[model samples]
Target: MISSVLVANRGEIARRVFRTARRMGIATVAVYSEADADAPHVAEADQAVLIGPAAARESYLVADKIIAAARATGAEAIHPGYGFLSENAAFAEAVIAAGLVWIGPPPAAILAMGLKDAAKALMIEAGVPVTPGYLGEDQSLARLQAEADAIGYPVLIKAVAGGGGKGMRKVDAAAGFAEALASCQREAAASFGDDKVLIEKYVTRPRHIEVQIFGDAHGEVVHLFERDCSLQRRHQKVIEEAPAPGMSAEARAAVTSAAVKAAKAVNYRGAGTVEFIADASEGLRPDRIWFMEMNTRLQVEHPVTEAVTGVDLVEWQFRVASGEPLPLRQDEITLNGHALEARLYAENPAGGFLPSIGVLEHFRMPAGIRVDSAVEEGDEVSPHYDPMIAKLIAHAPTREGASDRLAQACAEVEVWPVKTNAGFLARCLDHADFIAGDVDTGFIGARLDALAATPEPSDEALMVAAAAALGDQDGPATPWRDLTGFRLNAAPETTLRLYLDGRPVLASLPQGDVEADVLITGDEVIVFEAGEAYAFSARAPIADLDEAAGDGQIRSPMPGKVVAVSVSVGDTVTRGQVLMTLEAMKMEHGLTAPFDGEVEALLVSAGDQVSEGVSLARLKAAA
Candidate 1:
């Protein structure tokens, strides 16, 4: 029996695995890098061990280091949370060879499904449906181009070992195929250390659905229905839910069976996910479903499956690792209700979704909802790791109710200092297409303009701000009243300027209670009147206001080393023009000019390590 387990990853997944292990009376151990020394996962475990330096390649992905940590802590098993080295076949082999139980599928299973091209071929041989495309051995530029031509336009060039859309691109016309392939290859090489790619037909308006399958050493296997992960941004899932919104019974059954067959083919043990792409333009059908790939480890979106199925998948992983038979039969497993999960990322939605890093000053999530977070209020969102702060999940009797409850929970969640995607996620839930369950992978891209519309401040809210600002000073009489000013016949109208979402707006208050004209210098507002004016009192900086505005310089969006400088002092640039690029979290974000103006100063240069909100450049006001 496996008495102790070591989680070989960091953050929420480690915390999640520890929770399950503790429930089963199994001791849990945690391994951390230098940067994650104070991370919550390390503190949550029964024992902790330091592996190596801060870089992932030095710590988390160092198989030998993780194994040594497990050995030092006397852990009998290792659970590799997804990403890093979870799907690494050699890592699994090393763990088993070290006389530790590998709490995942066999290495053979991982090898079978690790490569997308290989997985597709295996699935086809196993009688599973696969999309028509090229999975040939030749990877020459000419060969791939020919495949694209034969498959027609709108082909998707994808890395054979890719996930999270890191190494994927869609070409709408043959003219852009070569450039897209080059870009995809570069990203694939950087992210996965493998540049080999494959081409497939890009299904327009496709729904991403995947089945959760669990297997045991005794040859028992069962499917846990399906989850819809179609709502995506930049090909990364933002929202996921169980018992997909508009799934047909026949389609669900077919996919579930195929998932079980896929697991059986690989002699898979423990938990795995079989992903499928469904043509949603015509609605879901059994014939429309095609195999995508399989995640050989526990998934980040597994909470929804647990909520609806009433099963702790982590517990099952431990049980199977202990050489136990399947806990429940296929007939006993059933979906109870609807469940939804929203990823709370430390990213700014209005600012191109660039990852935001800072010390979370205040973190408050709703009480009733399930929150799986890896960091605390005082914890820092480092540039070396993933930007996801937490996962908020809600379960209800129906899909609409679950979505509504999740939205309410998110609205109440407050995380100060660091900009988050909370507001944007709430907007997505309230979106018409999403609420109606008529969304696809292209939902965010299609509605980018509409969804990014900024909210307007209400009269009451503005009044509150003005009142707070006015009450802060020490004056004989009220600022709006006549005491210091000389003339009684005419009261002076004061002009107040404030920044909202990085843009300036002017408020003009007349002497009396009559309405005043307000000028919004930015784009139009959809939810409220942007330029409408109201009676003013004063203004004060609230907790939500950007603290960096007082610094008089534009800061980097995330923690990263500056890669390039586009301009120096006295150079004029327009809004949306690239200022510099910061590479972090395995991605590069271009810092852009906030407004059209002359560059006053450049604070940093290439190769300088900068934190989020560190001043990088300054823009002088336009004449």
Candidate 2:
């Protein structure tokens, strides 16, 4: 048995592994970068080590540093908790070379399933069904275009080494194939150091279903059911649950058996997920599902599996890595209640889903659920990392009950300053289609506008903010006496001027005890409702003298580096034309012209680091 373990990752995954390690009476180690010096995972570990700088390449992705840190801390084993080096075959080899137990699959298995093209070929050979695609060795532009033409329109260009929605794009026609291919290759080169790509037939009305499979060194593999990650936005999963809705026993058996077969083919060990794409146009059927790719590590949505299976997956990893057999036989494992997990990201959904970076002044998760988080109140959400703040999971005896409980939990979220997607997630959970279990990967993209729309604060919320503003005023010793201009004969109404998102709004609050949860921070009165925090200020709005009709100042939406400056001064541009692209929070945001105009000034160039609100260009109306 391993006495000490080092988690070669950060954020919630690191804390997750540490929790399981501590419960098993094992010592835990944590490795962090300068940016994460004060991260909760570091403080929670028995031993901590500084690996490198903030950028992931210099820190978390540097496998040598990870192994050296584990050695320095006397860690007997290394648990790569997904991302970074988790699926790096060479990294796994290096860990074993350094006499450290690797809490994952063997290097051969990782390499076997590392690239999408190779993995698909192997799956097809192993009798596991795969999506129809071109998995050739040719990497020329003409060759890929020809393949796309052969595969027909609506083809998908995927980075052979891609994961997490990066380095992937869907082209609906041949006219857009070249541009999408270039963009996909660029992202692939940057993210995976490999520009090689493959073409696949894009599945219309697709539902992402993946089976959780575990194997042991003793040559046994068992699946822990399947998860439906159909609720997605821009190909990134938002909400996930198990077992997939509308999944019949025949479909489940086919997918799960295929997953186990895939694992056995590679002699896989430990926890791995075999992802599949199902054509949901006619509901789930065994023949309609085909293999997508394999994620050879613990998934972000593994908590839902744990909640349903009553299994400690991390503990299983430790035991399996210690040369143990399977913990339970295939017939012994069983699924319990339905579980749902929503990823709470620090982002503004209505504002193009831009990542929000700042100190989390107020952070509170809903009660009566499982919350796996890394940051706490007052922690800074750095732009150098993923924007996800936490994962909230809820389980109930039935799917409807679980959905209602999870929706309520999301609605009860309380976060301030750092914007979160709690309201957006709650909206998705409560959507009529979602309630009826009619979901697919396109669910969120189709309803983004309605789901991400900024909600109008209820009259009750306005009243609470108004009361909080009155309470902040001086000369009021108690809430009863704080109501200024209160008239006992006129229903004791007090009118106050408040600013909502910099726009002035008039609100009236009753004199009697106003019941609402409100926080008065600095000059802002924040009211929480339906998982949204509305900040209202009693202070008057400031006038911007430079602001005028049809103003065209192109500003950075968030702190990031300019990737491509597409315009020059004096260039005439039309409304919706791309001005430049900003890379921030691991995603690119394109700055576009607000109206037809001439580029008056170019303030920044490509590769220049910029802060939020920094003006990049200026446009003047065309003559």
Superposition error at 431 for model 1 (Å): 0.9
* Residues 266-385, model 2: lDDT tens digits: 999999999999999999999999999999999999999999999999989999999999899999999898999999999999988999999887788999999999799878999988
> Each candidate: what lDDT?
0.82, 0.91
Error of 1 at 89 (Å): 0.7
lDDT of 1: 0.82
Per-candidate TM equals 0.84, 0.96
Checking candidate 1 for backbone clashes, the offending pairs are: 466-538, 469-539
User: In terms of TM-score, how similar is model 2 to the real structure?
Assistant: 0.96
* Worst 10 contiguous positions by lDDT, candidate 2: 479-488
Model 2 residue 40 CA deviation in Å: 0.4
Report lDDT (Cα) of residue 597, candidate 2.
89
